[model samples]
Every structure is written in C-alpha cells, then in structure tokens.
Target chain A: MNEVLLPGVGLRYEFDTAEGNRIGIVARRDGRFEVVDYDRRDPDRSRLLLRLTEEEADAVAEILGAPRIAERFADLTREVPGLSAGQVEVAADSRYVDRPLGETRARTRTGASIVAIVRGEAVIASPSPVEVLRAKDVLVVIGTPDGIAGVDRIIHAP
Target chain B: MHTSVALLLELGLILTALSALGALARRFALTPVPLYLLAGLALGEGGIAPVPAADEFVEIGAAIGVVLLLLTLGLEFSLGEFAASARRHVRSAVVDLVLNATPGAVVGWLVGLSPLGVLALAGATWVSSSGIIARLLTDLGRLGNRETPAVLSVLVLEDFAMAAYLPLLTVLAAGGSWWQAGLGVLLAVGAVAVAFVASRRWGHQIGRLLSHPEPEQLMLRVLGTTLVVAGLAELVGASAAVGAFLVGLTLTGVVADRARAVLAPLRDLFAATFFLAIGFAVDVRALLPLLPAAIALAAVTAGTKVLTGAYAASLDGVGRWGRLRAGTALIPRGEFSIVILGLAAVADPTLGALVTAYVLVLAITGPVLARLVRAPLPARSGPNVRVDRR
Candidate 1:
C-alpha cells in the first residue's frame, strides 16, 4: 500500500516490501520521515529511512564522494562494485560521523572489511583489518546491509 | 436467545472489555490491568452484571489466562538476547530477588499472612509488567536507548523469575509437601531446561506452521495452539498462561513474529475477555468490609515493592532518586496478583473475601502509586540523535 505524497493533487509512490523494508528515520532535505514500514516478521520495531531531497554544496560534501551502492540487488551475495546504489545507501545509513572502524567492519560481511577509517578532523587511510576500534572512527566499507546491521549489532551488543 | 447465545454474550462482555480496555488505556496513557480489575469490580456484585460472582470457576479460568499471558511474554524473549547477557542477567537476577523478597516476606507477615503466602505475594508483585511497560515505552519512543537495554535486561530476569515462581506456587497451592517443594523446584528447573531443548528441536517446525496457514483454517490453528498448549501446561503442574508463554517463547525467529502479527485478533480477543472477566466476575460489596485490610495491605505492599525496587535500581548505580523511580514503576499489582488471590481463595475457603479485597484495592490504586513514585520515561530517541550508527 502507498500514501499520497501530497495533501491534494496526487503524487504517490506505493511501497514495495519485496525490495526489502526501508524503516527508521529518513533524515532529508525536508523534515525527517519516520515511516513504519512492514516487516514480514515483527512489526513492533518500525524502521525509519530517509532521503536527501536537497543537495546544496555543503550537503554534497556530507554525501561522501558518491551515492551509495548497496540497494541494487535484492540480496548482497558476492563481490560487486561497492558503488552500487544499495551499497551507497548502506554507507549512508547514518548521517552521523563518529563511529568505530571495528564496529563498522563488524556490521558488514565477516569476509568484507573497511579498508579506510574516516571521522571528524582526521582520517585513517587503509587501516588494517585487525585494528581495534576507537569510538570516533567514521567507517567506509564493502559489505551487505545485513553485515552492516551485524556490525551495528556488535557495537551495541554489550 | 438460546443458552449458548446467552453464554456467548456473557463471554463477549468479559473479553471485549479486555481488548477495548487495553487499547483504550494505552490510548489514555494508563495501564490496562487495572482497567481490567476495575472492569472486574464494576461487573462484580455491585456494578452491572456479575460474572465472577465467586472466584472458583474464574479461578480455574484465570489459571488458563495466566498461561496465555505467559505465552505472549515468552514470545518476547529470545535465545540470542539471553545468550548475550547471561552473566549480567544472572547478577541482576540475584540482586533483584534478594532485594524484592526481603520486604515481600516481611510485609506479608506484618499484614498477618503466612510468610510463604507473603513471599508468594512478593514474588508475584516483584516482576513489573514488561509487556505493558515495553508497549508503553515503545509507543512513547523510549524503547531503544543506551539505558533502556540495561533496564530491559533487568526485566528479562524478572520475567524469568516470575515464570518460575508461578509453577512453584502452583505446586504448593496444589498441596505439595516440603519435600515435594524441593522436588518441585528441581522440576521447574527441569521445565526451563526442557523448554530450551524442545525449542531447539521443534522450534523451526512451530515457526513454519505459524507462517504457512490455510486461510480458512488459520483461526482454528491459532485457537488450537493456545488451548492444547495451555492444557499441557496444567497437566505438567504449570499455569496455562505460563504454558502459552512457553509456546510463544519457543517459537522464535522471523516466523514467530509473523505468527504473532497474524494471531493478533485472537490474542487481543482472548486477552480482552480475560481481563474483562476478571473485572466483571468479582463481588465488590463482599469485599467492601475488608477495605481497611486492603488499604493497609496496599500501603504495605506498595511500600515494600517500591522500597525494594529502589534498592535494586540503586545496585544499577543510578542516583538515590532515579532508583526510587524504578522502584515505583514496579508497584502496580495487576493480573497475576488478582489471579493469585483468586487461586488462594480456592485453595483455602476462609481467605477468599480478604484476598479479593487485597487484590481489588491494589489493582485500582496501583497506577496512581506508580506515577507518584516513578519519573516519566524519556521520549523516544530518534535514530539520528545517535552519536554513532555503526
């Protein structure tokens, strides 16, 4: 089912759950969107996903070089261009900057790793896979959304 | 109308109120259980139509209700969650039991009941309504927070304790001897073990059935599952509510959640009836003379749980006041307490009126006590507000 994007007139994009659910906050050019998308399983944890309608120069800088590459395939199974739309969305999961490299690595595929760690005011180019995660390491990685979700899981597990 | 139709009407009155109250209470920012008991009070001798005129039949039915309630509760816990925090949960459980039981036992005696009965009362009230609180918290958007996990961990332990406590109470209520008590404890420990093992073995199959239901047969399948499982729980000397809880517990994974969503109509239907029956079935005037006793008992019960819960919260290392709020949140004596009193009256004839009064007063005023003592849980934490989303 879909909701009308406008109050009157009609611009509506019916949701497609088969594409996998997009939930949680959608921080965007407009006010953030908190949509309760369907999960085939538990519906209690309504996910919120955002879209950036505005791309001014500073906003473009925050867009991180390229759009995400994660959303293309229904599922991420093998090595593919990390620049795929789906992958780009995966990287863009967080608008926030501070994160742990280890945690980011953990969220992605166990096979996949973050080759570079970037965060506020500083950057770690080609950080080793074994590097212990510090609190403020902004992560750039190659892996599936599940893997990223896993990494998010580990960081918050304790 | 035919007798069957009349019975249906009676049943509908009870259950509809149960669902509607839950929905309404949540809508109004009040808890559902008290609304249930108030429904009970209103439906009792004084209110409108009295269904729970005596606790005997309803007592047995309530046993079944508890089983169903637990079924829902068990669904909420996960092995992954358990595995992650086992050690901390153990520490938390130990701290909570001690803190909660001391006052529970003492106050039970001070109120002129057996220490065992008081201890039972304490145990029943010790655990807060996680489902109630969790739903409220989720609605309020405070469900996922840094501190919330810590709080949830505590609740899981308390829930586990409550699960175990009901079985032990059942055995004792059924006249198990002291020696049997030891054996009963051992058996309950075994039950948990059995629940885990069974879940491991049949969990997948249960989940699968939940997912692939025939459209015409879906209703039958869901109803059968609650009844058969709850019946089995009683056969094994556990409450049916706890049994339903176990069923929900075992059927984890994506499918369980799917089943839960589909089974919503049934759960809410039965659960609402269950609450409404609790309200309408009671005899209010018979309980009126016991007002002095109930008030004293309520004061003592609330005082004990709050004080003890505060102590438990303190161990979490929050400040004096925050701990106090946590303690206060634990105060409301809801369904289980009412069920226990009803069960006790069945087990012992002389005590029915007094116990009913005890549950009545506690149920009505408990929420007021909760608000007075606890801080409002913070508003929902926006995911964007996170410092790190890794």
Candidate 2:
C-alpha cells in the first residue's frame, strides 16, 4: 500500500490486492474515511464508494485481513487453555456455501459455533442463524481441537 | 425584600419551565430556540405575568450567551483554516454577503429604521446559524456530501465577515457622535487586526494556557478569560462578543477542542437564556404588527440564501440536485441572528419584535427545507456516501 498526503484535503492510501482488486482509502482530517473500490476490469471506473467512521473501517479491515482478528482476539485465546479460535475459508467445494447458518447445523453436529462470518470487506459478528453464508465467506469458529476438525469436515463436505 | 423573594421564585420557576421545554424540543427533534423565545415573551411585560425581578439577571445572562456563542463559533476554525477557507471560497462569501444581507437592509429601510437599526437588521439577516446548520447536516447525514464543503466554506466566511461586521455594527449601534462612532469603528478594526496578527504569531503559546486536562480547571480558565476579555471590549465600546470570538481564534490546537468540550453545556444554557431574553423584551402586541413584514423578509432572504449556496456549489461543479441541496441547507438561521438582535434590543423599540418574528420564520423552515431537498441519486457524487448507508 502507498499513502499520499493530499495537502488541504486528506490522506489517501492506495493498494492492489493479490486477487487484482484495486482499493483506495482516504482518511479525512475530520476522522472520517472514504473507501473507493475499483473494478479489476476497469481501474478507472469505481465500482463502490463508501464513507465510514474509524471504527467501521477497522471492523471491515479485520474481516479482509485474517491476521488482524488473530491479534484482536489474542486475549480470548489466552483465556481458554484447550479451546482454539480460527477462521475457515468457505471455498468452492464447501457444501454449506450459499446456505443459511441454521441449515448447516455445524454447531449442533460438531459443537463448534461460528462466532462471525467475514465476506469480502464486511464483518458480521455474532451472526444470526438466518444469515446466508456465501462463497469466499470466512467463518470464525471457536471450539476444542476435535470440535473444530468436525465442523471443518461439515463445511468442506462436497 | 418581598419583591426580591418574588424574583427568586419567578426565576426558579422560569428556569424549570425552560428546562422542560428544552426536553420537549429535543423529543420533537426541533431547535429549542423558538420555544425559549416564546417562553421569554410569555414571561415579559405584555404576557400573562411579567418577570419583574429576574429580568435584570436574565439580561446579564443573555449578554454572556452572546459572548459564548461567538466564542464557540470562533473555536470551530483555527486562524489557518479560517484564512485558507476565506481565500479559497472568497467568491461564495462575496455572493453570500450580497445576496443574504440585502433583504434585511432593504426591509429595515422600508420599515423606517434609523441607519443603525438598518445595520442591525442586515447583520441579523447576513449570518446563518452555524450551530443549527452543523446539527442539521449531521442529522441528515450530509456532512460527507459533495456540497458540504461549499456549505462549510460559506459559514467560515460569514464568521470571518463577522470579525469585521460585528465591530462595525457595535460601533454604529453604540449611539454616539458621528466622529466618536467613526473612531470607535477604526479602533475596533485595529483591535481585530491586531488580534488576527497575534493569533498567527503566538496562537500556540496562547493555546497552551488553555490546555489543562482537568475539566473543571479548564472550564474556569476558559470562561474566566473569555468574560474578562468580553468585559474589556464592552468597556471600550466594541461588542464583547467580538472579543470573545477573537479569544477563540487565538486558542488553537488541542486546547480549542478541549475548551469546546468543557464549555458547550454552559454555552447552551446561556445561549438559550439569550434567546429567551430576546423574547422577554418583545411586546407580544408589537409582534402581531410586524408579523407580515417579518414573513415577507424571511421569504425574500430564504431565496437569496439558496441562490448564494446554489451559485457557489455550481461553480464547484456539483450536480443540479447537489446545488439545490446546498442552497436549501443554508436556510436555517439560528443563534447569530438573535445575538445581533440581542445587542439591538435596548436601542430600538420594534427591532426586537421584528427580528424575533423574522428569525423564527427562517429557523424553523431552514432545517425542514434542508431535509426536503436531499438528492436521491448519489451518481457521480463526492467521495463519501457508503458509511452513511449503514
């Protein structure tokens, strides 16, 4: 990421993701952030524009970047001796992809509850059962090692 | 002694009533200014029961209110921001001055006011309520809109203009010989210019004096300094509010924000009293006579304010709806108008009633119009709209 100071305006941070998505975040002096997403096909044409408070921007960044949540939830890991918290990628082969959380029943069968689901740059924490999981959804689950493995099987089932 | 006790009881009851009204206004999402004014009117000479004892105290409180209002306004812009915004948006500021101020002056003239009264009316009409405008923008989620910067720049310019206009009006309204008034004006101009230079040179050092972390200490220091300076300005025949404003400009950096946090509630309390005192001075009977003229003047000035915003936004290449939104958002006039009229309250008989009626009309309409003129489509918009959606 490259950050440029636009004098008299604000600070603009621009970067390209490994997936070839272009993003630019402008942090205004008034403590607001403007996030601009460009279509990979046409870098000049913006696909989405968003204004966010600092907190919202931080939340979104945590979802997109996996290491952020690990650092943020380090205390939780330390509080539980045997328990672990990790994110699982819902790839193309995942059977529960595009299905609602209630229908998957991963919590009921494996004793591993999905605490959050991160899709793209959006974070849905303490999600309701009706929330539909989609491809590229990253599920943040908490359980014992055995439970996590069981739920991982449930999601990855083809 | 009996009258003194009566005054104490009356003041206590009036304050309690005003607090209730303030709550009600908040519940209705309305600015409590008109309500406060109405309460003042109801308690004044022509109302059901007049406040004889507490009127003097209320008058002093109202003066403090004006100083605090101007001071907080000054705190919002540092000298650098003020100077930069003025330079960049000089065109809009000029347009605003010409368009918004003329209607009041013309109306003042039509009503056969003295030259000073006309000047007071112009000052009343010229500036928009920064407090109201800022609140409405936040409420309507338009702070990130394309036209917001245009709106903000005009507001800053008006404040900058006030640095000059306020002194001019104060001197003229002080009621002295022509030479004395002229000298006062020159002296005021010199004082403001000196303050500006001092702010540029030693604003940081001044800022350090106000940087106490303890809220109580901070409040005491800030308010004490403001009142002393304000009193000195009034002693010199310039408006105390102008001195308070210059003090605000001088305290830059973190201290300005901290002072704002500490001083806001006091400002609100005193400012509400200021509005109430204006209402208190007004004869209810006089209001009916001036109602028509006030409405007519409000209608004209509203159009002109909109034009000022639209023209400036258009120059900035904002879209049609954005321009309209800019114009309508500029409508609400609040504290500043009342502060100006508050100074003129004693000088002219009909000035209070006329200004009260005029400001009430626009202050109510301004926020409603701002909410109404929002553009539905955010196409080709400025950089920030996504966060507002959530």
Query: Alpha-carbon error at A45 in model 1, in Å?
Result: 21
lDDT of 2 at A4: 45
Structural similarity to truth (TM-score) of each candidate: 0.62, 0.72
> Candidate 2: which stretches are off by over 4 Å?
A1-158, B1-8, B177-179, B376-390
Residue clash pairs of candidate 2: A50-B386, A51-B386, A51-B387
State the lDDT of candidate 2 residue by residue for A1-158, as single tens digits.
Answer: 77544322345577888887677776765556776765443333333367678678757766678777755555687788988877777864355655798988888998888888888557899999999888668888888888878877888876
- Of candidate 1 chain A, the 10-residue stretch with the lowest lDDT total is A3-12
**Deviation in Å, model 2, residue B66 alpha carbon:** 1.0
All-Cα superposition RMSD per candidate: 13.5, 13.7
For candidate 2, write residues B282-341 as lDDT tens digits. 999999999999999999989999999898778767777778888988888878888888
Q: Give the Å shift of residue B85 in candidate 1.
A: 4.7
- What residue runs in model 1 are displaced by over 4 Å at the alpha carbon? A1-67, A70-158, B1-5, B8-24, B45-48, B51-64, B83-86, B89-91, B110-116, B139-141, B144-147, B213-226, B279-282, B301-304, B307-321, B349-390
The 0-to-1 C-alpha lDDT of every candidate, in the order given, reads: 0.53, 0.77
DockQ for all models, in order?
Answer: 0.04, 0.05
lDDT of 2 at B340: 83
The TM-score obtained by model 1 is 0.62
Candidate 2 TM-score versus the reference: 0.72
